[model samples]
Target chain A: MILKRVFLNRLSGTWMLITLVIILSLPLVIGIALYLKASPIFESQSLYQLIVSTDWSPCNGNFGFWPFIFSSLYVTVLSFLFAAPICLFAAIYLTQFSSKRLIQLMHPVIDILAGIPSVIYGMWGIIIIVPFVSDVLAPLINIKSSGYSILAGGIVLAVMCIPYMLNMLIETFNTVPIGLKEASLSLGATSWESVKHVVIKKSYPGIISSFGLGIAKAFGETLAVMMVVGNMVQLSFNPFEAGYPLPALIANNYGEMLSIPMYDSALMFAAFILLVVVLVINLVFRYFIHKTQSQ
Target chain B: MNKQKEIEELFFKFLSGFATYSLIAILGFIIIIIFVKGFGALSLDMIIKTPKGGYYYGGEGGVLNAIVGSLYIAFGATFIAILIGIPAALYINVHLVRYKRIQNTIRYFLDALWGIPSIVYGAFGFTLMLFLGMNASLLAGIITVAFLITPIIIRTFDEVLSTIPKGLHEASLALGSTRTEMAFKVMFKQGFSGFITAVLLAFGRGIGDAASILFTAGYTDLIPTHLDEPAATLPLAIFFQLSSPIPEVRERAYAAAAILTIIILIISLTARGFSKKYSKSNLK
Candidate 1:
């Protein structure tokens, strides 16, 4: 029995170690595979060439990613434009003026929004947002209704991102000391003045980190954006124009990529680019969270 | 100046308050649209039978294949995730608790893991499958999802485990118990409900996500009978239907979304209920 106990304990320890190894090494395996599969194309093309060129046609062996990259940036920026103020002020209101009851009520709603599948968000966008934009929104902006455009993608992304942004910002806002708010109020600063000058100022770094996280999320979204983003290869400043971002580019073409020469490598290259950008953002977000937590 | 400050305060106050409260309108609007449009699309066959005769092209049949596939992948992934996640959570909190920097470093990796996009996982899984010479299959989907949720499970479970009073751990150690024993018997007991909550949370995330499994799982017309075969999932179902040129099939996308939403709602509510019950009993 004693020997059995000893063996069991040792087995348990081994199991934990094995789990650790598996989790830690999965990323390495993925990274290496991405590098290997993408290197042939990488060797042929310079980073500068890839970033500057605008064409991405497989028939011509051209895989310029500038359009995809700019589309991603445009939509991400637009999503933040829609999401930031609403999320910021709402988070401020939530932490400052909201009652406990209201907070409790909002928790499940936000969780529900967060819990809803991304594709469902896509579904919603297709049914409601897409039509509204095509019929009403685009016409308002004097563009023909394409029903799928950067504006549609951006709006859907904002809804999807709001839950995450609010979660992060609310936590940051909550950490602002009550004493500071009280001190501001005692000095005759109004609630808005105190919140604007004190709470938001104090939590600016955290807010920026949260936005970084949101950008990572916005950049990586695939199914929802793919549905509404009207996956075309184009570089234009018009939000009404249909465009392809990196995730959409990868998703739309990865299946038939092997059918075309170098297409597999090109799509793999896209995935590699996305992974690097997102990882950097995530690392920045982690640093910000750690800094705030330490403070 | 005083009057201006007062006016500005009230204006900003109402604006911020409007921003805060507008979430209700937005959420309600989204859910209402799903229901109003999706209601016509739901039918008896949707829940019970597999798609028949090119349903993606607007034919007869249901999403039974996708439903089962999603369950198989999510449950399978969660099982693997729990096996690794619980052990990892306990290890970091127990074995490496004294080394705060190491723990934080480990946690930061996990955080980054969670933050990586589902599509990246899909792409990564696609690559991994190619390396193994494996076709897209239920097994591949499960493995990818296992990677997807490991960080979520670990982090949520860690939050619960970390909140356990230090006295409990010290007490267990004073009794000459091994840290492993303390983890399972004492800390596990204290964090039992949280484990449940964390599992459900991960499962909800797993089932809801389509991007990670999109390439790894591969769509099929029939329910997955074996882990070696490709399996369909609800999110992919919605995607296929929405992409179909047929308006009827397109409408079916909303029905699929409605069904997916209901499943997630049930999971969230159940998780909350169990956690609430445990919290009440945990008042001591």
Candidate 2:
């Protein structure tokens, strides 16, 4: 009986290891498959041309990704600009200043905020943000266009990513030793002084990674941004101008991709780029988290 | 100099307070908007009947198909996720506990996977479907969602398992139990509540997701009777309804969002309740 049990453990353990290996290899395998499938059809065009050219005309075989790439960075950067200060302040408030009761109350709220669906965010963006941008904000700024613009996308993306950024920043702030903060206070530093001097300095690495995580989320976000980004394939920096990001382009167009020549290849390349960039950002973010954790 | 320092301190303090309250205000406003905008448009028929015509131009019928479809896809995906997630988590905690390097590497990959956006997973699934000569169906959506939520489940549950004292494991081993036995019989008790929380969190995530299912789960008015049949979901339903040029259809989108929010609220509340209950009866 004991021998049988021991053998079962070995068998199951081997199976578990095999499963682990397969799960780890899935991304690489999919990436290679996507690359192979993409490379053949785009063989006529240089990869450089495809990446650098601003044109996205599938009929003309101009599969340049410059517009989409720039648009993604533009909107993601705009979101960071809008979201970073509030999230940092909120984290500082919760970690350094809030009472225990307030902390207990606020933690669940943050978690619930994190749990809300991205698509509901799209609904909110459509109902509230779109018209506010087009009718009110844009007119105030003397810009004229549809409600769905890069600015709208950036605003909605900021809201969508705030909870995640707050969670990370708060966790980072909580990691600061109580002794350090108390010592700063004992040396004639006010509460804000300690936060500004010791807390912020100690947690800068985590805060940066939190920002990276937020940027990655906005960069890769599709549905909500798709609802608001207006999906105009263009290379523009004007916040009011309509634009398309890579994920939004794929989301909106992939259904009809079979009919368009070289469309699939172009789209595949975009996905690959997004996947790789997101993976790299997350790896760096994890490095920060791991470093802090080990300390 | 003293006045300037005091003013600076007050300014920073006010800024932090304003930021926190702004978050609270935003949450309040979103909830109010959904309920108020959705109240008049929310009809019992929408919950009980499928759209009679197409889901365009403010058409008739309810989101019965979508509600049913959403539940099916989420539950199906959760079932698959839990099966693989729990065992994989068990493997890491029990089998690989001695090999810190291998465990960290595995965790590193999972975190990376978690960070990969749902849309990328959708694109990857779409590509894989094309390669397999299979069309979009409920099965495809479920599989995609399962892949999407696995990392979440494993990571959350892994944290739970990690909370168990090291002495408990040592004690179990000293009592002539194998690692597998110890995992299932000893550590599992302490982690079961957390396991529930992990699955619920993944379920909430799976149901609310629209991107991963956009292409894979082809829309249908009927509740899916087979795995191959296309199915409607609440998020996609809201997306399509809100896209309509008609004002009435747009209002229905708010109603759908309200429903989605309520379900998630219930899940989170129930999770808190579960934690309270389990902690009271905790072994440690």
**How many clashes show up in model 2?**
1
Model 1 off-target regions past 4 Å? A1-3
Model 2, residue B94: distance off in Å is 0.9
Model 1 chain A lowest lDDT segment of ten: A1-10
Tell me the deviation in Å of residue A117 in model 1: 0.7
The sequence of per-residue lDDT tens digits that candidate 2 reaches over residues A1-295 is 9998798778766765665665677678767866876785568788788778897788987788899998899989999999999999999998888888877877778778788888887778887999999999999979896888999999989988899899989989988999999999999988899999999999889999999988988899999898998998877778899989889988888778889888888888888888889988998888777767766
lDDT of 1 at B62: 85
lDDT of 1 by residue, A131-161 (tens): 9999998888788968899999999999999
lDDT of 2 by residue, B214-236 (tens): 97988988889999899999999
Error of 2 at A92 (Å): 0.5
> Which residue pairs collide, candidate 2?
B46-B62
- Write down the TM-score of every candidate: 0.97, 0.97
